[model samples]
Target chain A: MSDFTTWDILRNLLLAARWTVLLSLVSFIGGGIVGALLLFARTAKGKAGPAFVKTYVELFQGTPLLMQLFLAFFGLGLFGIDVPAWLAASVALILWSAAFLTEIWRGCVESIARGQWEASASLGMGYVQQMRHVVLPQALRIAVPPTVGFSVQVVKGTALTSIIGFVELSKAGTVVTNATFEPFKVYGLVALIYFCLCWPLSKSSQILERKLNVAHRNH
Target chain B: MNYTFDFGWLIEYWPVLLKGIGITVELTLVGGVLGVALGIACAWARALGPGWLRPVVAAYVELIRNTPFLIQLFFIFFGLPALGLRMSELQAANLAMVVNLGAYGCEIIRAGIQATPKGQFEAGASLGMSRLQTFWYVVLIPALQRIWPALSSQIVIVMLGSAAVSQIAAEDLTFAANFIQSRTFRAFESYFVATLIYLALAIALRQLLRGLGWTLFPKRTAR
Candidate 1:
């Protein structure tokens, strides 16, 4: 019912983009912490920890993130735990991101040769010490590219939070579309913003992979 | 917390849920088949096709890969009519999934194509095969064989991501959950059931794809 010029739309969307960036950062950082813990548990000596982490990762990965967000928003409310959209979105995205991150990191950690573990043990190094001293440092290097790459996923994922009523870029786009009746321009701009945010991360991930491989070859 | 869970709505809502599941599977089947076909074409173009086409294919792949599926769907469903391009919700959803999976599948298939041995191409040339013939009979099959697992995983991802189509009222499985919850006021139960169904679908799809891979690439299984 109001006139919205191109600049008006762009300004509103840009303002909302901050929430998108913040949510991505929160989920990525939180997911990384949780994923690291799961990675340790997954690689720990014993059956239970690894198995539990495996199931945890599988369950999260197997379902849609939208369903997860719905369950978080409504499921939490069912128990009288009134959750705001941002909290629900953050929690669901964190858990989902953690699942993928743990799996990605597990692959990286496992790629460290078995000899490294055996040699560390022979040197009287404990599991934690071997991981801390040798395996993780090496794994961290390989992990950087994919981790940065997955950050793009985290950013794209923040788009889903809009479905749960979070006033992020995508949601803002929808609201602006209603106000301006310009769904084409609004959604196109939304896609462009997402592309700008994600392409650099995707490109860097590819470059990092190539760079790391060169370093490995030179070694 | 003293919250009593009621799945009583299931009896009444079974048909709606069934229809939803049916649509979701239909979307997946159509999206998966057509998507992989488009991917194969793009992969060929990027990897082995003419010089002018590679950048064009690369730009499409990069654009799709870097954006979220939801915006793409919104663009197609809500945004496209401004240019006189119109489609039904279901059509838009299917098109979105196909386009989404094609980009991902292109990259995956390209990786496989890139991994092909240089000797294979020369061998094909010596066998009197044209470049397209060589790609078809010699390179493409083995490349697909090498990347079947990865491609299958991407399809599953695209299938899961299809849940977002419900935002446009496309009546997929997630839409079923939303419907049942609104009617029953059993939001958690409805979503919980839907989540489990998705898990089942994902697992089943993975297994089905694994079997399909073995059938398609018998040599892999033999080896």
Candidate 2:
């Protein structure tokens, strides 16, 4: 009854996959920037800074990403803001990813040891200088694997944005499924596409983890 | 800024909200228990079971870990019907959660198992214990103790992700939020309340898991 050949479905889903990749990139980059700021605040030697960052991370981490998308989509509407689905999805994902990234990075930062801080302080280094020069370089090396690993999550998260009507790969699968009456094939292709996107990231994260931890392995 | 925030719909929709929460909890309980059990079996397969099973379990872990939970749910709920395997939305949701968590739990539990000192296995052998008995009595408990925190986090994560089950009309907590919003046209309020309830549930689940850890591994708590 429908004219959606296999090629047609594949082509449409591929087109939508572009948006999935783009959204993942946008949120990962945006979340990285915000997460870095939160990481600094969280690691800084102050009561309020750590507490505030903690609450922000906990709030985002505790709630469902779907609910976060809904709030961004509709809560903004209550304030006379014309929120588009893409905007809501991007903003919500950025915030959500930032929370996780901040927490992940906090662990990396904390692993740098209190001795490093004391030694830096003994050299008359301020907190900023110590962090910029002494701590971050070490933390950055440790953080790379986990950060890359989290990109897989960001990519998968873009799937949830389809519910908010962003028309990404998963949404395209649904649309194509309706048109072609081939739910199994369409969804199977969708899963295959996601696995293709995600597997490399997961593999590289494992490789990076092993490679980066070589120094500690001897200990 | 003259908009008034009204939550009068809460009075009427409380039952719906309660049912949603109940279902969400039920999903988490069943998913957590079965998923971890499946994880244990897979972990054993990968770590100590037959050599042929290692690659099979590895592939399953990688496949589930790499894909989004929603697509897995969709495959089970919508895609499987094409092959003549039919089930209710809740069953599909439960199955998806179990599958998703099992993959993750396998990885986490495997890490714990790998950390087991070689001496422990030999000690079990010297004690005249069979391989399975050695695994059950000497290996699994300590391994579980080591990875309990990570497993707890994954379970909580699976619970939060269960929100996606609502997309297939599984009547989860997120579904309640969607239903209430559609009925009352209070989209923001409905989602806001649901989000808070999710936050509460997450906190409660974490605490419960921590308590369970204490109960299960009393030696660790005593330390």
List, residue by residue over A1-219, the lDDT tens digit for candidate 2: 758778888999999999999999999999999999999899888799999999999999999899999999998788897889999999999999999999999999989989999999999999899999999999999999999999999999999999999999999999998888899999999999999999999999999999999998974
Cα lDDT for residue B204, candidate 2: 100
Interface RMSD of each: 0.8, 0.9
> Which CAPRI tier for candidate 2?
high
Off by over 4 Å in 2: B220-223
CA error at residue A94 for candidate 2, angstroms: 0.5
What is candidate 1's lDDT per residue for B79-99, written digit by digit as tens? 999999999999999999999
Candidate 1 predicts chain B with a TM-score of 0.98
Q: At residue A174, what lDDT does model 2 achieve?
A: 93
Give Cα distance to truth, residue B32, candidate 1, Å.
0.1
